[model samples]
Target: MITKPQFKSNDYKNGLYLVATPIGNLKDISFRSLEVLAKSDYILCEDTRVSKNLLEKYQIKSKLISNHKFNEKKNTLQIIEYLKSGKLISLISDAGTPSISDPGLVLVNECIRNNLNIFSIPGPSAVTTAVAASGFSDKFLFYGFLPEKKNQIEDEIKKLSNFNHCLVFFSSSKKLNKLIPAFKKFFTGRKIVFCRELSKLYEEYIRKNIDELELFNNELKGELTIVISEKKEEKASQKLSESDINLIKRMINKLTTKEITDLICTNKNIPKKVVYNFCLKLKNEI
Candidate 1:
């Protein structure tokens, strides 16, 4: 039998802690996560009632503050003030990691603006869990949860049409009827893995050709994580685009290679390594 791990009291810092709670199983919560919860001064939860179930299981009694979608904007100022005052604040979603598809983005942004330290406890995530289970290409663009409507979903797919990467996104069970067919029409011939209720008792995976996905007529439950493999013909780009080349040429004489790399990577659509190599080639000539 595997003995339960014990945790030492970490010198809790005065910063924002982003804790990742379990998506389904409570037992998956790590020793560090429990320690953070036990030690944090204020815990911002997406749902107090739901989070209480997890906290109670571990005997953690940290002060819980409501921070869901409905009230996040209203609470941002107060949360930032708490951080500024050197209070130990923890942000947690009801399940899984916070701020991926959850409501911690506002608080995080505010904390960033005020120059407060933010630490990630780094535990469970639906994106990584599903991707690991699917045996698909590791290179993926996780779009979090896509818009509900058909038109918006199509528009989003159209925007990402140029990039040939394994695509990851979340959707509700109701949208499976629309989502499967939309993906078929927009991204045909690709293989997709629809993981339903990951890390739970009823977890199911439906890996089928995108063209054949419409035939899945069974009622699906829990949240869905969809991963669409890249088309074989559309290889990942190695060379920079003409526009990126022009940008690099324009900035070559004006900035350091590292500075140019940072600017291009931050503002342009080019990859960092690609831009860095371009800078190196320019640096050699200089």
Candidate 2:
């Protein structure tokens, strides 16, 4: 809750500043972020060239150092030594906030362990920016990036579908085509918002049902954030009653243990593990 006393660049000094840059539109940056960058002794960036473009645009002159994932571990010590000399330092990612699905966590953690002061100059974040304009409840869950494996993705989406709030995640344009179908399978009738190139001139929020979104042609492009509305409320998952078990047995009679387990799980809308373990106990009794 510390407040900057003034908007002057020289006002900031001698500590680690975690500055938030624009996710898309460069103008989305805050005054404080600019001041911190301008005043810092040097800036640690995911890419020095990318940070240089932003600095040149703003007419701010500061030393630049590359601190991406590959070099972050080794560079952290050097940055800390600079800070130990009472030099003001700032960290920025290519886009959005640092350490949020981006590079910055290691150096920040090191700074924390070294007992150095770290301050945040808030600006744009694709997750919150998309969520704010999503027309969905604020209680939504944010999964920074979708799982890469198809089975893992499906399971994760299925778990999120059971929740009662919106879900947000980042995906490449390549994965978007594959993701929509899975969303339809799990969430069915829910609405989705595909926020592309947010805050930039080409920014667009394409709202459609997951089923309908699946019909969109391939070659969709841009950095994408997919927001899916929660499914209609259903009864919570709990142990099934005897009546429920009887209904499942009717559908799976004389079926193998695997078949019985699957039918019982679908009937009770519970996790397969729970149903499988229960079916194992029933087999032991017989």
Best by lDDT: 1
Per-residue lDDT of model 1, residues 158-210, tens digit only: 77655688899988787777776678777887889999878888888888987
User: What are the runs in model 1 whose C-alpha is more than 4 Å off?
Assistant: 1-10, 234-286
Tens-place lDDT per residue, model 2, 172-191, is: 88877777768888888788
Instruction: Give each model's whole-structure lDDT.
Output: 0.84, 0.82
Question: Model 2, 202: alpha-carbon shift in Å?
Answer: 1.3
TM-score of 2: 0.76
Off by over 4 Å in 2: 1-10, 234-286
Clashes of each: 0, 0
